[model samples]
Target: MTLLLLLDDPAQPGVVELQSLTDDGLPEGSVSVAADDLASAVREREADRPRWVWDDTSRRYPPLLAAGVRVERCHDLRLCHAILRRSVYSQSSTLAGAPPGPWDGPREPPPVEGSLFDDVGPSVVADPLAELREQLAAVAGADEPGRLRLLLAAESTGALIAAEMQRDGMPWSVETHDALLVSLLGERPRSGRPPKLEALADEVRAALGQPSLNLDSQPDLLRGLRAAGCDVESTRTWEIKALEHPVRDPLLAYKKLSRLLSANGWAWMEAWVHDGRFRPDYVPGGVVTGRWATSGGGALQLPASIRAAVRADPGWKLVVADAAQLEPRVLAAMSGDTAMAAAGRKADLYQGVVDAGIVETRSEAKYAMLGAIYGATTGPSAVLMPRLTRAYPHAVALVEAGARAGERGDVVSTWLGRTSPRPDAAWQAEHAAASAEGAGADDVRAARRRGRDWGRFTRNFIVQGTAAEWALCWMASLRRRLLELDGRPHLVFFLHDEVMVHAPAEVADEVAVAMRSSAVEAGRLLFGATPVEFALNVAVVDSYDQAK
Candidate 1:
């Protein structure tokens, strides 16, 4: 069963229009519900458990979630439209071939409810019925509609989760965060400069022998460091780490404190965390590789140093589950390499590779395998590459093919259906200019460099993109399982390969089992009968920091 709810405004009445969509994308009939009566209408239909279809899950679902209504399933048009438009599977479909118009850009969901874009009109976006028809046609005509459908469903579920997670909010301890900031950066200063940070800055200045040097300015700091006899090109963290100087430790300390203050210090806590929750706006399918990105509050890059601040409620526990070596396991399954799959069965993938006798040490195995997927053609990774190739030929060949395709400027598709973006017109012009008659050596070298860089991107794209799909399926399945378990355990935080669920202490064991089961289910859904095992290290702890 499916219901399509079109929202109007929140203050006045509830939803204005509702329809039941058939399998063929036609609305069997429309349901008329007054503004204030929408929740009851949804509640009445909840018995049927219809999968809701809406323009944007983020837009339409928040109102329902606010009204204490949670749907079992939904199809988010904003997310699906984005996926189908970029997918190679639907290249020949009507939606794919349609005029290059409105659908190119997504219908933006309101940042906060009832601010702007409350107008419901014909041109708001493509008509819901018409858009649905095109989407279904696109799916029906896809090369593998089943897989594309799975991808669409999983992607939509992710959108719903993003909204719900934001609304429900992640359990955060503002007090704990403030205390950690104080411990590391000293108390918030009257002049707004962290005291500890100022102390470190003084130390840096004394070490560099520049009494009046402005450490805040990159150019000034660089000059001062050079004057102190540390010859370095830039003040970048990686470059600074390699240089040994009297000011090195203090400089590093200053950087760490500066990042903490600028990125996630006292101001961040006051603005983002409220009522013991850190509710960042999450953008689903935000990354090119289909990873989620936070719009504000830097949720995706939550510092490990502040992990202690992410605490559960007094009686609840945070069940943290991170997929161990997710990408390598995905590669093993995609490449159909039994040897690699066998290696993946062990806890540490690099150690597993060492046990297989492919590399001399765990470090060698890690570097070599990463190099193969990421196109690292030189350095120690290249030196150890031959042994990895001999040990896992299939997996090695798979990424190599992707890289070759990229070098030729061909687009690559992930396991499910997300296609890589084509190179821009500038890239083509540069390559053409390089290959033209009497091209300069610099031009040829530049073109070759760009081509190789693009090759590396595509090489990682296939593996990273596929790994993202696996994660989507994992979360989607886990959400359903968590829903079944009395709604006590709810997904609260999600990083790329990790998820945190806030659950009651008594249900911790059940949540752990569900976490492992969801991993297997996700693998089965994506790779069906493959030998690869996606293992997760699950821990039920009071604070999220304790999990790792």
Candidate 2:
């Protein structure tokens, strides 16, 4: 059964309308419930295990979670609509050709005082039922309906997981965090930079022979560096590291400390951590390639120096797991490259490449494989590309094909049906001007450079996008498995290709098994019966830093 959940009416400020439907989305029955009774109504209906279809999971699920109610499955209409409205496979569907509507904007947060539909107007009245039917038609008429269906399901499941993870929050230790900060930064100051950071800035200024140089200002620092006999164009670490000068060490130290202090310093702990948990606002499908993005907290960019603060609660453990060589394994599976799959069979893919005599060392293999997916044109990656191509032609060919398609201003789809957006009008205009009669050499050069840059984006897009799909499937499977366990073993944090589950110590070992098996299931879901192995390094630890 499919339950279409929506606001009751614009006049009814705090009522909800629930319409029951068959699997094909045909209406069967309906009910209206007040906002105050929503949790009980939902809980009652959940006994049937119906897949709840709502406008946005973030807006609908969070309230129920707060009431201590959880659902087994849901279909997030907003997320599904986004997928169907742009997917190449659904080009002929009406939803794809329709003009932008209310479904296109950012999701609304759950109302704190009134009904979600109270502000609905004639122009903005987006009926969830109408959108649901259109999405169903689009997926039904898609070229690869099976793949599209899987992508939508995985994407919607991701939305639910994001909300649940936010509700549960990652276990955090504020005391450990403050101690680590003090140890590295020499005490949090009342109104300025910490002592160690200030001292490093002073050292940099003295070495550069500028007593009043503003270390915080890049332009001023770059001018000071140049005046001190250093020919550098930028303050990037790579550029500064190559120059030999007294200012080098001090400037690098200052920059590193500055980042640590600014990114996840004492101020961050006070704002994000609450009680014993760190809750980050996760934005699903936030990246164009389908990777998640944090709206405020630096969840994705958790620094290694302070990971020790991610301590498990009493009698609980953090089961951390991350896939090795994720992109390459994804490339192998999606392309159906049996040879590449064989290389990674029961072993590290990079090491497998070395054993296969493709490259002399593991580092070279790493560079070459990453170079292929990321479209590297120079340096060690370019040097090692030929050998890698010769060894794994099928895998190389897949990314190369995507690059060619992007250069032609065409869209490319991932293993599932998430398509890369077409180049904008400005990009088209640039290409047109370069191709005009008697075009300048400079114009042609600029056009070629821009084309290569976009090509690189599309080349990585296919692999990265598919890898993200795999991750969604992995988490979805693991989510179900964790619910089957005896204790409260729930996912609390997730970075791309890595996840941390907070579970009882007695169930930590079970969590490890679930993590491994779910990885296999994710692979099978994405690529059925493939030889590729999506191996994970599962570690049961007391703190995030303890994991490899």
Candidate 1 segments exceeding 4 Å error: 3-15, 106-123
Q: Whole-model Cα lDDT per candidate?
A: 0.85, 0.89
Candidate 2 collision pairs: none
Model 2: runs farther than 4 Å from truth? 110-125
lDDT of candidate 1 over 1-548, digit per residue (tens):
56564544333443366777788777678766674566667777878988777778766667667677777788887778878887899998877777766667755654354322233333346466677778889999999999999999999899889988887889999888989998998988878568888888889989887888898899999999888899899999988888887788889989988998888988888899989999898888898889999878998888889999999898788999999989888999999988999999898988999998888898898899888988898998999989888999999999999998887788898999998998899888888999999999999999988988998999999999999999999999999999878646898889999999999888888999999999999999999999888999999998878997
Estimate, for each residue in 435-518, the C-alpha lDDT of model 2 and write its tens digit: 999999999999988898889999999999999999999999999999999987999998889999999999999999999999
Pairs that clash in candidate 1: 14-35
Measured against the true structure, the TM-scores of the candidates, in listed sequence, are 0.95, 0.97
Give the lowest summed-lDDT range of ten residues in model 2: 115-124
State the displacement of the C-alpha of residue 308, model 2, in Å, after optimal TM-score superposition. 0.2
Model 2 whole-model lDDT (C-alpha atoms): 0.89
